[model samples]
Target: MVLSQNEFLPRAESTLARLEGAVLDALSHHGKPSVSSLAGVFRQEARLSPSQLAQALCPGPLSPIGFAALVMRELLAPVDVVLEGSVSEARVVTGNARAPSSLRVTCPLIVLGDLEVEGVLEDCGPDSTVVVLGRCTAWGLQTSGNFLVLGDLVVRDVIQGVYNDESLVVAGDLTTRFLDENDHDVTCYGEVHAEHHLENGRSGDAAVTLASTFLRPELWNVDLGELHHDALFERIQEGEPVFTDAPQAPQVREPDAPTAEELEGLDIEGIAAQASTNARAKDVVYAQRKTGEVWLMRPGSLPLHIFDGKQLLGQGTPPALDVKQRASERVTFWRKRGDLFLEIERFGAVVQLHAGQNNGSLRTFRFAFATPDDAAQEVRRLEARYTGDFLRVTSMIPGRGPLERELANYGGPKTEYTSAIVDGTTLVTRDGERQRFDDEASALSALEDWLAGKRQAGFDLKILEWKPYGLLG
Candidate 1:
């Protein structure tokens, strides 16, 4: 009888408009209708019946999303509001103001000024957690489940979106500089950045994985990693060792760069042994973050964990090498469906692979600890398939250079930490061609490749995005 949170959002939006209009008329009449037509449309306009609108939209023991995430923690985690001691206007100042979205904590969530959120934002409620410590502002921040911020929830400025299975954090620094935009599907479990754009507008395919999103075309569906920082590859090319390069400034110097005799016999020491690796990547990618706990991923993955049933969250490694490409290098190994993958040097962030023999057994590919930009920002929240398009990778300011070395460097297509497949092509770099494609549902099918100079005649494709460590390699 405590029914509040705006009276359960108009009775869960009228039971989600009568369960989305009787599940779209029983899937458009293929028909399986009887729950008595979802209980006669919730007893005609929510009078309630037909099994109380099918247990209030499928609620077993009070479940309409666990009773609206327990009435959003009994009405906004005790928020009363009215600051001005340091500043106010719905400002959610916090020392510990009841934030715990799965505890990681460090400090940073300081709003300092300007905020105006109304509904949503419990940080994905469920035990209702949040780990912010300083710097967190709001013009918008909506949530329902699982919110975990550690520091720098800086809008410096504006936002507006955050639905929720939940996770938005900033351990050390993530300055949107002045926001106004950066919604890339609004799902960061951790590590997001902005100097200019992470996603303020062309949000694009989003399902994100930004450790740095200055935005250009750094879209996502899954697996996006960045560390030293490159802002998330953007050049759009797909098909033929995935190409893009040519937006320089990650480090600065141009007047005519390229000359150790044009970078000496290529592979420049395997790009300096993958920029001396150890930025972290020894096969991670795991899910199911609770109970025994798991969230260990680095070379990236995550779109929503689909249903958030959340499981797995294992595997972990990748860190030793650094002494500059282990001394000597030439990486670009290959193996598609059988397993084993490699395509570093230019093609980056495609870790481990493995997995191939499931039903018949034989799938190991381990790596027990090391990939964590907050487990590689949970790979944007799962769900991604690839084939073509992308040449993105940018930088303009003190941002960075050496093409940000694909953040940690791995290379695409060749999944298997959980999903399958292996080997997805990787090679061709002079500047970093963020993307290239032929077809695979045009997000560039995990960076395609078959080569033959990508059948060039006059070929001129473009799709590059750039920043936090947002994405690269």
Candidate 2:
């Protein structure tokens, strides 16, 4: 019988452990194991291929250069050309040529004519170098050592320098899709252009134009410029747009707002019953379509709010006074010392606790709790924690700007289609029209259709995410 995944995993792990011990014993017996000796051990025992052996030896991540070197060593491959004598010895190529898919050079290399590399061009060790007298083209170019180009250098995908000892010098223009240089120097005598540039290293003389700058997680010390620390984190986590400016709000022409007469004729109670039956419904209220706009109403035919296709407009009076009183009684707030601002307010059935200080730098924060009692508990916790330090009260609560943006523009990274799931209903905004789906499953199917169309037009498919903000820590 075939073992289940749970059972198979343990057996697989134990087998791997035995294989590792056998390999280790074989290495000890051989003293200095070469590729041929390792192959014999693998064939006789584990029967692992060169690639699998490499993976077993280095399970986790390795630098691109290091990975390529390991693969070459496991395959017992030779370099395209070898330089004799010392490490400083030079190997010269007279004409244009495409380098091997993977190359590791121990000595300096000089190409008099244009050089093209389909894959990676890396160093065997530190101080191993490369020099191109003419233009150079590559898919991926990396160096743990030094590299110089007398002419222009163009990389289709990525070009990076490793460690503080490496230096990249280009006498002419440098162009790449992505450029990463950290703890090293990249000197360009002419212009430098990249689709995405990451620089945490020393800058050199070059006119640089970067379409976007990648902010890696490790480089938190880099200046945020205009963005706040929390805001930056939110943007990255939510997959929101960072490089571009805030998009202009779409000019939406909504249908006329439903008046009291329109509400009187419709069976609002029946609509509410249908909405309540949906398993995904969270809020007390539900929506019904009138004309083209959607109206939000409670079970008792109380029209609380209206959405004009895109924008939410408050039209009706607040919910019943009894409902408000019940919500208010659960929450309590007390400020002991310095001047601070705190208030409990309700939008529809949802209650929000707004807290902040008067200082301009300290922003007002809006916290949405499931119930007023929860909000009250949070308030008490924050008050007691910062009893002596009231000025820094805003630190506990973050601003709602990021959350708001995330809700309004809910789409995959670099997607133009705007979509959001509001109260169990999916709303997709494409072109100038807003399309509504009664359930999330139907909405996901619609989104997939759009992604399929994009894929047909030479673009990768990216489906919309319902609520990416839930991933926030």
Best candidate (score: TM-score): 2
- Model 1 misplacement above 4 A: 4-79, 82-136, 139-154, 157-195, 199-225, 228-248, 252-473
C-alpha lDDT values of all predictions: 0.27, 0.41
Task: Please give the lDDT score at residue 244 for candidate 1.
Answer: 22
Which numbered prediction scores highest in lDDT against the true structure?
A: 2
User: TM-scores across all candidates?
Assistant: 0.21, 0.28
What TM value does model 2 have?
A: 0.28
Candidate 2 least-lDDT 10 residues: 399-408
* CA-only RMSD, every prediction: 24.1, 22.6
Off by over 4 Å in 2: 1-90, 200-473
Candidate 2 residue lDDT tens string, 355-380:
32222111112345566567567656
